[model samples]
Target: MIEVRNLTKRYGPLTVVDDLSFTVQAGQVTGFLGPNGAGKTTTMRMIVGLAAPDRGSVTVSGRRYADIAVPLSEVGALLDAGAVHGGRTAYDHLWALAASNGLPRRRVGEVLARTGMASVAAKRAGGFSLGMRQRLGIAAALLGDPRVLIFDEPVNGLDPEGIRWVRELMRSLAAEGRAVLVSSHLMSEMAQTADHLVVIGRGRLIADTSMSEFMRSAGEGTVHVRAADPGALALRLSAAGAGVREGLESSLVVSGMTAGDVGRIAAYHGLALSELTPQRASLEDAFMELTAGSVDYQGVTS
Candidate 1:
């Protein structure tokens, strides 16, 4: 497991991470989410000892990353896929990292094949595409088969197939009882990939919850109803304290009430209903609402 308790980081006058705390448990994928410049990368760096936190602590299995004798075997991370030497081959890059960590050289070929880079293992790092580079980075992270893994934007430039591949790979890693923390801007993908979420904005924690609970706490979902007497039903629902608004095709969007309540009200009035659907807020909707005020920059249009 990975534990970050009140983790804080600063640079001169600017604070990049502020009192952040979350746990990435084994056997699950915890998605680290935020807007641009939300300090996600900085937090990941702090976890791996790339940057020292000004305060608080981050530990793997109850030990600071620096304290772990064989750090790679305890925690693996892919912060920047392009941070490797451009002149080296994919195979050479992993070899160097393994050597530095005192890991076996045989793991090199295993990870190359595991990340589907076996065919291009000899290709120079500078010549690889972004997706291929991502694969190589992941291969390096898996070099030690660590129990904790951190991946920052692993699918940044991947195609649909590549994205699916990464999704499955992360799932499999979690299934193998490893703590997986992934950071991404893709809401749709995160919805399907992550079991838990740590959302932040403007260097502060916004929310830390499971996917289902987050959606449920986003307030009551609006109910869409298509009734035989649309006009009469709207008035009755409005009178019953439901916020009613016109919807497409002679339907009413009723808020501040549940679908069961709406259906019962329509039935009491003897109004036949064709559709009574509850529209829950999606992940993107909830994220936008939660982080609306914390965006660093906003484009304005007149």
Candidate 2:
């Protein structure tokens, strides 16, 4: 498991991460979400000991990342896919890392094949496309077969098939009891991949909750009701303190009320309903609603 407590970082006068605390538990995929300039990169850097925190602590398992004798064996990270040396072949690069970390050379080959980079192992990283570079980076991260993994935008340049591969890979990693923390801006993918979420905005913690709970807490969701007598049902629902609006095909959109309550009201008034369905907010809609104030850059609207 990965733990972050009271973590803070600053540059000049601007504080980036402020008193952020969260845990990435074992056997689960925790999504790290934030708008641009929300200090996500800084937090990830601090966790891996690439950047020093001004206050607080980050630990993998029970010890700091730096304290681990074989850091790569305990924690694997892919912060920047393009940070590799372009002059080196993919195989050479993995071999170098394994050598430096005292890992077996065969592990390099295993990871290359695991990440679907076996065919391009001899190719220089400089000649690889962005997607290929991402795969190579993933291969490096898995070389150590670490118990904990951190990935920042792992699917950045991947195509649909590659994206699906990553999604499945993350799930499989968590299934094996590895703590996986991934940060990404793709809401649709995140919705499908993450079991839990840690959302941040402007260097502070906004939300940390299970994906299902977060969606439920986003709003009560609107209820769609189509009754035999639309006008009378709307009147009764409005009088019961529910916000009712006209919807397509003479249906009523209702808020501030549950489906059960709507049904009860309809039944109480002897109103026959043709259709009653609840429409919950999508992940993208909920994210935008919650992070509205935290966006650092907003485009001008005409």
Candidate 3:
């Protein structure tokens, strides 16, 4: 398991990650989510000892990363594809990292095949595309077969097929009882890939819960009812303490009332009900609501 307790980081006069505490358990993929510049990269770096936390601690098993004799075997990470040498072939790069960690050379072939980079194993990294470079980075991360793995936006520039490949790869890694933590700004993708989530804003954790639980907490369930006289329906629902809002042309969005309740109300009022459907907010909707105020960057039209 990967455990972080009150983890904090700072640079000069700025604090990026602050008093963050969370646990990434084995046998599942936990997504690390936040807005741009929310310190996700910094936190991942601290996890692998690439950058030191100014406060608190991050540990693999029960030991600090620095204290783990063979840190690679305990935790492996892919922070950025560009971290590798541009002039070196994928094979050569993996060989160097393995040599530095005293890992066997055969594992190089294993990870290359696992990440589907075997075809391009001999190609120089500088000549590879972004997706191929991501695969190469993942291959290097798997070189140690660590119990815990971290990937920062592993599918940033991939096509649908490549994204699916990465998703399946994460699942397979967790199936073997390894803890997996993947960071991404893509909510739709993360919803499909992660079983749990760690949502953060302004360098602080907003939520640390299972995907189902977080959705349940932030998601609202409403009933949509359409009637010939929505004004009458609205008045009745309002009198019944159900919040009602205009929806579409002749429909009312009713809150605090179930479909059955709406049906009963319509029958009691002798109203002609055309449609009544229940709507529950999705993960994507809930994420937008929760982080609406915390978003740091957005694409704007000039």
Candidate 4:
């Protein structure tokens, strides 16, 4: 488990992280989320002691990363794809990481095998593709076999298949009882990967909750229904105080009523129904919906 307390970081007049505090529990992948320039990276840096916060601290398990002896055994982190020697082979890179923490050289090979980089273990890191480099970085992190893992955009530049590999890897790590904290702008992948979500905007904690809870709270209830008589159903439902609109070909979107209610109403009116289900918003939609107003910088649409 990791605990962050009152973590605040300021750059002269600019405050990148503000009074952030949260706990990342073991056996769960907690998403560290925010829009670009929302200070997610800064907070991650502070957590691992890459940057000192002006007003607080972070601890892995029980003590600060700096004070934790054999840090590699305590925490494993992959912050960048370029965190390796260009000329060194992937195996050598992992070897160096293991060496730094007095880990066994065999760990390098083990992690390489675990990360599915055994074939490319002898390849130069510089020539590896982004996905390969990511795998290599992960191998390095796992060389220590630490109890906590921190990955900052681990899926960045990964192709679809590679992305799934990383997602499953994070889940496996969490299942094995390691505390996993991953930061990503990819809400879709986070939705499938993370169990807990910590959302930050403008460098402050906006929401800290379980993935299910967050989705339930942000996913406003709506009913999706398909019927042969679309026009009749919409009119009838609307008249009955249900807000209904054409959803798709022969479907209607109904709000202010449950799916069961809509189904019963349709049955009462003798309207043949095809599909009747509650429409839950996608996690990406839910995240955008929750943090839209908190976004510090909006992309120019022009």
Model 2 RMSD, rounded to 1 decimal:
3.2
Better of 3 and 4 by TM-score: 4
lDDT of 3 by residue, 156-242 (tens): 778999999999999899999999999987787888889899988878999999999988896468899999888988898899889
User: lDDT tens string, model 1, 1-302?
Assistant: 98999999999999999999989889999999999999999999999999999999999999999999988899999999998899999999999999999999999999999999999988899998999999999999999989999999999878999999999999999999999999998998898999999999978999999988988888877899999889999999999999999999989999999999999999999999999999987788889899998899889999
Q: Where in model 4 is the C-alpha error above 4 Å? A: 245-250, 299-302
Better of 1 and 2 by TM-score: 1
How high is each candidate's TM-score? Answer: 0.86, 0.85, 0.85, 0.90
lDDT score, candidate 4, position 193: 98
Off by over 4 Å in 3: 222-277, 298-302
Best by lDDT: 2
- Alpha carbon deviation, residue 119, candidate 2 (Å): 1.1
lDDT of 2 by residue, 1-302 (tens): 99999999999899999999999999999999999999999999999999999999999999998899988899999999998999999999999999999999999999999999999999999999899999999998998999999999999899999999999999999999999999999999999999999999999999999999999988977899999999999999999999999999999999999998999999999999999899887788889989999998999999
Relative to the true structure, candidate 1 reaches a TM of: 0.86
Candidate 4 residue 263 Cα shift, in angstroms, is: 2.5
| Candidate 4 Cα lDDT to native | 0.89
Model-by-model lDDT, in order?
A: 0.93, 0.95, 0.89, 0.89
Candidate numbers sorted by TM-score from highest down: 4, 1, 2, 3
The Cα RMSD in angstroms, rounded to one decimal, for candidate 3 relative to the true structure is 3.2
Query: Please, what are the lDDT tens digits per residue for candidate 4 over residues 1-302?
Result: 99999999999999999999999999999999988888888988887899988998899998998998898899988898888889999888888878878999989889999989999888899999888888888887787889899999999878998899999999999999999999988988999999999999888899999999998886466888988888888988898899887776767889888888888888999999989989777888788888898886677986
lDDT of 2 at 186: 96
